[model samples]
Target: MHRFKGRVGLCAMVALGVVTACGGSPDPARPAGEKQQEQQAASRSGEASPGEDRAVTWANDYCGAVSELVRSVSEMPIIDASSPRRASETSGELLKVMVGGLDRTLDRLDNLGAPPVDGAERVRRDAVATYADIREHAQAALSELSAAEGPEASRDAVSSVRKPLDDLGGVDLLAGFDTVPALQEASRQAPACRTLTDADPDPRIDSPGS
Candidate 1:
């Protein structure tokens, strides 16, 4: 992905993770298409019954956030690109993995409508850990990217974030929503999310849910 699309957004961190904070929008002329897609995706959440669309939308949005980061990292440095150049950027792309993972997790959570009050405790605990893992690795990469300037370092830092996510793949998380499906769905959730939050948001239309 291009640098413009590399940094990530803190949607979950702002809306769900921590206290809220307001801010201005991105470049208006840069491209309204992405914004429009995001709006459409958000609106979709409100459109269907709680689980109907939220699971897919949220998951896709979440995954897309990280995917954008992945793409950003992947695209960083020209083999000659400066570290400061790459590191100074990427909140847009890198953080998306956590955001996307949370989004997808939330969608499953909403769908399941909170696990049982008994063993459900374990699920929540596990989820928090999962989310934390997502956040930690992403943050680590971003921090390294921010600090380094060499293309090799920038690339290495960004690539470092990939394995953790790859390890997270196809976990059958969210009650049979396999990692592949969840990631694919999350990827396909919105045109805008894809336009902005994803490095490669192309729908895996080959699979019905992907």
Candidate 2:
């Protein structure tokens, strides 16, 4: 029932590195030896550092999960406002899929832990908070739909969460990588992560009314 909006603007903002939560240049004063160590580690690992690699890896996985969830939501049959029972059933199933996907995504992020690079801790915290907020909103929407007694009430319940859901749709999973030069460069080199482009728009769910 909640109407989500175009995430194009959010994606554009992210592409422009305008996310204050994760925006900043890497520290210029970092020791030269540290850079050398990172390069040496990259050689030994034959890939990015553990932290940057993990961030890219998890980001790719999260993107896949989000894509699948979007596909599922898009494929769902639209329910009539007069068919409250059908709406409830369909919405329940959709929310279940969404909540599960979000949980798994969060779990992967948690397991990956924050990137160990300088100035990345705050970005990681913000990313995790954003994911948690989306999950909370989804749960709340589900609860509202479940508690509604009739078709009109159910529609109203769904409508109430529209903005929250829209906000979730606008979240940029890669926002955390913007501030870390190492991660950004690594993401560019990684095929899986690199495939995600500024021009690639986020997947969207249609409003219930549509």
RMSD for each of the candidates: 16.4, 10.5
Model 1 misplacement above 4 A: 1-92, 100-117, 175-210
Candidate models: Cα lDDT each: 0.44, 0.56
User: On residues 128-204, what C-alpha lDDT tens digit does candidate 1 reach at each position?
Assistant: 56655655665666566667667677666666655445544423233222334533453345443455433332321
The number of residue pairs in model 2 that clash at the backbone is 0
Q: Report the lDDT tens digits of candidate 2 across residue range 61-159.
A: 444434433444444445444666766776666666667757765675566544445655665567668867877987888898888987788778767
For candidate 2, the C-alpha RMSD (Å) to the true structure equals 10.5
Model 2 alpha-carbon drift over 4 Å, by segment = 1-82, 198-210
Supply every candidate's count of residue pairs whose N, Cα or C atoms clash at under 3 angstroms: 23, 0
